[model samples]
Target chain A: MSGNILEVSGLTKTVGGGKKIVDGLSFDMKKGEILGLLGPNGAGKTTTIRMIVGLMSKTDGSVTINGRDLDEQGKACRANIGAIVENPTFYEYMSGYKNLKLWGRMAGGSVTEERISEVVSLVKLEDAIKDKVKKYSLGMKQRLGVAQAILHRPSLLILDEPTNGLDPKGIRELRDYLRELADEGISTLVSSHLLSEMQLMCDRVVIMEKGKVIDISDLSSLNAYGDKDQVAVSISVKKGQGEAAKTAVSVLEEVTVASHETENELLLDMGRDRIPELNRVLVKAGIDVFGIESKRTSLEEKFLQLTSGKADKEAN
Target chain B: MFALLHNEWSKLWNKKQPWIFIGILIVISIGTAFLYTAFDTLEGAGTEGDGENWEVTLELENEQYAQTIAESDDEWEREFAQDRIEENEALLAAGVDPNETNNAVFLNEMIYVGTAFITLFAVILASTIVSSEQDKGTLKHLFVRPYERWQFLVAKFITVILFAAVMLVTVTAVQYLMGTIMFGTGSFSTPVVEYGMGGVITTTVAEVFPQKIGLYFLNMLMFVVISFSISILFKSQTLAVGIGIFILFGTNILQGFAPLLQDYFWYPYVFLPHMTLQSYVVTDEFIPGVGLGFSLAVLAVYAVLFLGAATAFFQKRDLV
Candidate 1:
């Protein structure tokens, strides 16, 4: 069952100042899926989320949350959505517990004090929840913010830059908590410019740039390029014979070669499917081969390749 | 609505300014009464030096007493002189007249004048009632709730009204207490000024309680309407308060110098002039072209226009 909780089609917004902050953006999150919205700065991620939550009127297109039309039945539609926009502005003079309780009341029938307590525990803010929000550290405030969003048990949760200003440990904890939330069958859409964190946390990612969706892929697919088989061939020859092997491997059509003059080792980067052919070719070319191994790839390189590849393709 | 009322009541009661308003009312009412009574009592003292016309008449009577003592044959003149002296002494010894009390009038006047303080509080309290939430970026949280936008606007308006009522009641109570203590509780009544509205529309001061309450209610109502609109429009409490007070008092300041622009500016609604519960006490007959009712009607129209505008704009406003 493709249980899509939020389906936004052709969503666009032009602010009063005559700028198109959101342009033709469309995406969805399935039940039990955590979709990360990744983009660079000024990429309209916040604007898209705001439009989805009905905090903004779209200049064009429609957003349906849990199949309720946002414009025709705004309050009813928004009932199924919980969003933590920006800093999650709360009454600072109030305690975190009071703030959550008030938000719970605002969230209506689905929320209760017991649920508030549950959310606080979910965010690991049980100890500081009683303290005034103004006294909270940045990480604690963010955790409290998340607690407020989930207090109502909204079927769809949208968090804009949820892990911002958090330390690494806090970010990890937040990621773990979000995963646990998704495990309970809740749908989440988290936006961030940090691709690395997005790779680790999101079940899937919708890549946006310049107010438009450039790509949407599951985590496996987004990082698929990184995990592609690229066998690293490390070969050691007699001293002063490394250059000859590098020269010989350089002529191979299916492989790229690199050599360290002092180390007497040459590394051959070729696809696994092509590796056997290249090895046969290298043996035929009279290059001495010593060692061969594969190294783990990185999401950063994959993201760069995807974005840059798209840019190059567009240029063509 | 009940939850909204509870929140509003809590915020109002938690503040200190309401008590301060009561304190001002008590101090001014008592102080004015003591000063006015002292002035009246001192004025009743002897007709010494006999310079003014009334004092000259008393001096002339005293001279006649001296002449009768010199003649002495009838003693009737002497009796008359003794009677005159006793009458003047009695007049000098009498305290202020209880019937002609300006203390109540002055206390009521003080209440009218002190509305500026209330306006100041209204500005600060109601200005960012909604906008500040937007400014601090909290409005999204408010909007995502199940409540309709109109309910939020109504909640804010209700809160402002409650605060204003609390201030009015506390101040009036304190002033009433002070008036009783200092001016003596002999009578708490003003003589009914009978004025018929028309041939069949007969009304008196005693019968015009509705009109009086209506006028008080209207004055604060206008303040509420104006403050609510301006606060929503400006989105800054300080600016709303500053502008609201300015409009309330500034119009009066301009009206005071009406000789310069009275023709151009046809008397704007001065908040102080409309604050009195004694509408008849301060009524002015329309002189040829200028009508008091015309200005009041204009104010009434403005109040309606402000409320309509507030509802239209606030209801549609995106919380951001």
Candidate 2:
């Protein structure tokens, strides 16, 4: 990652009734990076994003986007950003093209008709662009939201659950589209509670719990805790072979073996360097070895461990 | 700013609400024309004798009293005086006579009444222009755009004024055509201004031209500012419209008796003598020696203050 494109420090928002929804939250997103904000309900992710976009005022703290203070130069700062704060409300009575055209004007660029048509095609809404937005399906609306956010080619894009209501196919399309955007050097921040999807899309993830940032880590770092560094070797053996397998496993130092009577087998977890030693020990012990395999940790296991395990519970 | 203006302009022209308002105005025009036409035909030859006509009853009472004064017998004189007193009482019970004297006067009165109805549309239209976005949650989408808050508000304000102007002209045109065809294209009977002995002055009904333009434009502007201020204050279209209509009507009624509060400390500021555009139209008293110029200046100040507050509040508001 390059230098940070968006930095929020000590952000707090105490709503009207004296409740602090977001307190002391801080995070940094680097250039051309895709950061996912993962949180449960009432975790203050939306509130923090609103404040950053200048839609909701911060109770105390600062937000800088592309090195410009959000408060000091709000217009200048927001000019470089585009956000889809929630479900992306649009003028429902207006046609899709008209809605984008109106917002594209407000986005303030050299937004030509050609550029608008290009965006329409980019979102894959070319056939339906002339239809009123009220008639659009939820998936279509989601795409339209993406189209509007990226219309001006803003450097920093913020989406709150951009795929909140999409089906399987739409979600995959959105994933690819977001990846393409990041590849084009646009920094994006996407918020979602879909952990697996986030793991797949984000270069890094920031998980919040109860109004604070609980963890911020790259995908590799999150994997470190749950990854499998040992290789497994399964060997077929004769009936009444438990004692023999145990003796055989004992020969390979630092190998842990467990026997299953029903299958008449031994399962071994050993380091890559010890695989040959285990084979020699098994052969010396006169046990027939079937196969050896290595399995890496899946993202689902890493996500659950990172989000639900004691490491985060204790940190929070 | 220009882009915001263009967006607002398109919303105003293409929305269903403005067309609905225009449709309402059309219905009102047709209704007013029918009501006035029926009244004119019934009072055929301008005899002013229809029992339903309140102004006619007052005129008859005055004539009866003149005849009663010419009698000589004491009992007869007393009896005639009692008859005259009874007639006067009957006339008063019919309520204040609306000034529908002739076709010209009636048309002018219709314009005044139409102004009130049109004010409702202006207030609601302007308030909704800003507050509806907030209510519908569309404002968040708008706020995240590059446009400044003040520019957005100004564009909304301009759209409201243009909407109000179109409604005003449509109603005025319909009334003008009906009034001309029915009233024989007569020159205005009342003078623009009248001067009594020793430079004492009296206003009349004839000066409705430029003064009508002034009153309608000024009142429209005032209503726009008022609606916009309330819209920003409440951030709700329904409340803004309701409160605006109540204040518009309430202030007029209160100002009718405002001269009674001349001894109070707050009379000058509460002096809302502006509903009677005819008083301004006829007497040149709207500004007295200074004329319409002074009246316009005072109105401008109110407009600026309210619109400025709207700008300030909108800019500072958290887009919920």
Candidate 3:
């Protein structure tokens, strides 16, 4: 209730007679926070989620949920967690309402009819709740999956690639619902390869590579790492002054010209405080400055750089 | 555990499989009764011209079997002739028509036919209980619940057993209705002769009918445990069912070969030799040294071993 809602330390999983699929991975999630697990193919994101949810056994280390150890007090720990590993599977032949009832009873709490109805509406599936799951669209199924997981209102919710087959609108709706859930104090751990979606959905992210935690940072702070004092700025100049503008920005002592958007516009890497200094320097050199704007690196770019082995250079 | 079992039961009841199986049993039950009635009517019509009473027919069959016993040099032939002669003598003295279509005969034949169908349905149920969840990828959902792995498994185990019981009761009820409507409840107190390992036994239809049904249920349990265990170990519904049905039918073939291998030390321990609980129910013995107690004990051991293995494997296995 006070500390982290979920904490995983030194978790390791080995398969095929000693092939370590997940090695020494550790992270934590605070209450009401949305944590994203990002990794490339075969980076063990699913394996880590599976181990945490007890779908797959861990070879070593421990998982503590709601201050209860998973190995020592599994039932107590698991009682606080609701998870859907990979694609959510359901009894497709049954109605979505029945599926919820089935899991609701198994969820080990007083799941009333009102609660089931509330969750059904929460996932926006009220119109289709009585329909067979086999008739549901992929996005509807994903929402139903979320409904099932949160039926008991567990302290921590884990979803592994919950948006695997969702369309754009469905993904947006899911992201919005997850944020709404987080605001209600349900800590969530989501594993997804969709960096853009993770950026929009997650509060903090743990980036993994080859079964190891490569990086963990706030979504806003990911671009701030290694460039804490510098900001990417783009300056627009008069139509034919692009070269002169680039030359003028290159000559500035505080700024490093990064690229040119056009013959008249130039991009620079400089401190936010020094942006005015460069603008003044360019204006004083008889340059026609149209506008200057600071640009931040996108999460997709940062993700590619980190996973492509440029993390060390970028972090430094 | 109760909640888990309740959930399992609900899921099973919600599916169309059990209902479909029930429908199949009903159709087969009514169909068998109608077919038997038709065949009985046809035979009675054809045999009326012979002018031979039921007693005269039995006497003639007994004389023929006695002559065969006297002339036959083969041991098995002599034994078969002697048993038939004794059966005829008993029927003749009891004034019971062997060809009569009565409620007792209906129930008895229904039990025999129903056991085969019930075994088939039970095998299908047990084999798919675990493996279908795995195949559908719904097992991970169950595993993530607060219940222990064995609780889910044991729930499924109990559900399959319950399903078999339900099927047995249903078949019996349908057969009873059909028999009452068609055969007028033909005196449940009437006597019937049953062949068993200890030779032959005579008992009232009321007593023997329930015992036969109970023995069939026990036989189903024996197969259910094995099939359920196979489902857990292999995680393949097809394999579990295939092997289950193979064992079900294969035991009959093995029974034929059993007499030849009766001298082997492991013959009694082999499951096929004891698959038929009818032998124990009738004569209280299946083989020379194997009695009711011994057969039930062996089956109990196999059941325990199967369930233990299923629990152990499911507990440790990763739900991939």
Candidate 4:
């Protein structure tokens, strides 16, 4: 049950003019894992997602979902996956309920009346389900989108930029729903440039840039990235003692000076267990430690450690 | 497959376009019935004898037509006189008077009228089905499901054909009822005039009804195939519908230019001139040499080509 749910190997999409919109890229998701494709706009995150879901053709590479090859067993492979690409669009003239029922019919009878009601309730769209989608708000549409994607009980769910237009509360609720789905052993591949939302939603993040995956880091627990078990500790000292603090902690083996925040402050990347030892060395150097705080592990910390590139892309 | 068709059918009726089209058809049908009544009365004006002595009047007209048929040197003029004489003889032999207004005559006149409108609506439906989904961004949802890309195309194609069939039948039904209500019920065995190989022909309304409807349906289907595939292959819905309308009305307009252009090798091969397939019910020859089978085969080949190109382009298109 814990094996890989989706494996995309060397997936590529070359558009007209012979330019590759999505270069050869590969990534995988374990069963029940929440994987995030983190990238700025124009990074080909959407293109890669489209190729996996069969919305677009791949110039090269293979995708296997639930042990079925996507190219060889397209229908069988799609049966196991549900998706929300960018904004969800339903028939504007139809009620939300009818829209779901239409999709239910397309799912080949796997979606029952009970299942429809259950999914509607899961997204808390019970009240608005009977209303036409043309009358729905953006937030309500997003909720219905989630309901539509998960209606068939697909083993794998893919959402591209699910947080594009959601409010803070709506995004939090979506995060909660996704985590709840993960608890039920359903895997999700969510793509977004909203690093902070991905921070709270995904169990792992695959950072992409310019149609290529640059890094894949585990974010389920604190700091499972470069230098395992390490944390970013910022030690603020007396104005003149910053240099002395630096010289004093130079003797430590596992600690690296991460970055300097101010003239009187220094940031250190060291093992969590070595925090006290490094603090003692600074005090032993006749430096008064004014504020010594260990920062919580986050994607922000990883972005700083991995690359100096822009971390958060606020794309629409 | 049932589910897919049901979904398509629901989508078509759920929108406002079909309702508006139906409403307009009803209004126009009623208007045409009244217009025809007015014209019928105007032509038979000012004389009670004109209404009562139609048999003597037709005999006199037939004698003149017979003289033209025997004396006219022009081949088309001779054919025209021959057509008129035979048409009057059929009515006289059937003992049906032309001055008598009846539902059968109304139906016989209007049966093929609504097909132009039906083809218009079908073209609109077929042109918009796929492209509208793409415009709304829901096409990717359709493609990502557990169905092949061509299944959606096939479903849409079938849906358009069904729509055309329904419209054709519905419009005819409405016309028949209006005719019955406006005029007196007439015999189905009333002689209907038609043009055939080298001469005019006459058959009963009951005999020609099915042939006219069936041939027109086949013609409209070819229209749907061309427009549906164009919309799928191209991104612009307007261009597809435009081409469809051009093919619809252009068939008649281009015929005025046919004599000047008929010498070209490509003229007979052009499917536009052959689109009026219902004419085949009256005559085997479309032009000098083209027959019903050859025209049908040409239309089928064009349909396959348009649909093939559309499916190929659609299957590979990146919906992003």
DockQ values, each candidate:
0.46, 0.59, 0.75, 0.76
How many backbone clashes does every candidate have?
A: 0, 3, 1, 0
Report how far off residue A250 is in candidate 1 (Å): 7.8
Q: Which pairs of residues collide in model 1?
A: none
Model 4 lDDT tens row, A1-316:
3289999899888888988878879998999999999877888999999989998889999999998899899999998988999999899999999999999998988899999999999999989999999999988999999999999999999999998899988898899999999999999999998877888888899888778878898886753444346787899999977787888988999789987757799998888778878878887888988988887688865754554555443342
Maximum-lDDT candidate: 4
Q: How much TM-score does chain B earn in each model?
A: 0.64, 0.73, 0.89, 0.88
Q: Compose the digit string of candidate 1's lDDT tens values, residues B39-73.
A: 64565454333323544455565677777777887
Point out the worst 10-residue segment of candidate 2 chain B by lDDT. B191-200
Place model 1 in a CAPRI quality band: acceptable
Residue-wise lDDT of candidate 3 within A1-316, one digit each (tens)?
A: 5489989999999999898889999998888999999877678999998888888889999998988889988877777888888888999989999999899988765799999999999999999999999999999999999999999988899999988889999999989888889999999999987777888899899998889998897886644545345777888889989998887777777678788767888888787777777877789889888898887766776777777754333322
Tell the DockQ for candidate 2: 0.59
Q: TM-score of every model?
A: 0.75, 0.78, 0.92, 0.90
Q: What would the per-residue lDDT of candidate 3 be over residues B212-304, giving only the tens digit for each residue?
A: 887778888899988989989888999999999999988888889877898888888877777888766667556677787788888898889
User: After superposition, which runs of candidate 4 have C-alpha atoms over 4 Å from their true positions?
Assistant: A223-228, A235-266, A274-291, A304-307, A310-316, B50-52, B60-94, B195-199
Give me the candidate number with maximum DockQ.
4
Q: Worst ten-residue run, lDDT, model 3 chain B?
A: B43-52
Chain B TM-score, model 4, reads 0.88
Question: Each candidate's lDDT (Cα)?
Answer: 0.67, 0.74, 0.85, 0.85
| TM-score ranking from best candidate downward | 3, 4, 2, 1
lDDT per residue as tens, model 2, A1-316: 2378999899999987988899899999999999988876677888888888888889998899888889898888788787888787878888889899898888765678888898889889999999999999999988999898889888999998887778989989989888899999999999887777787788898888777887786875444433335555566666666577677688666777744545567666666566667667767888765654543344444545655764333422
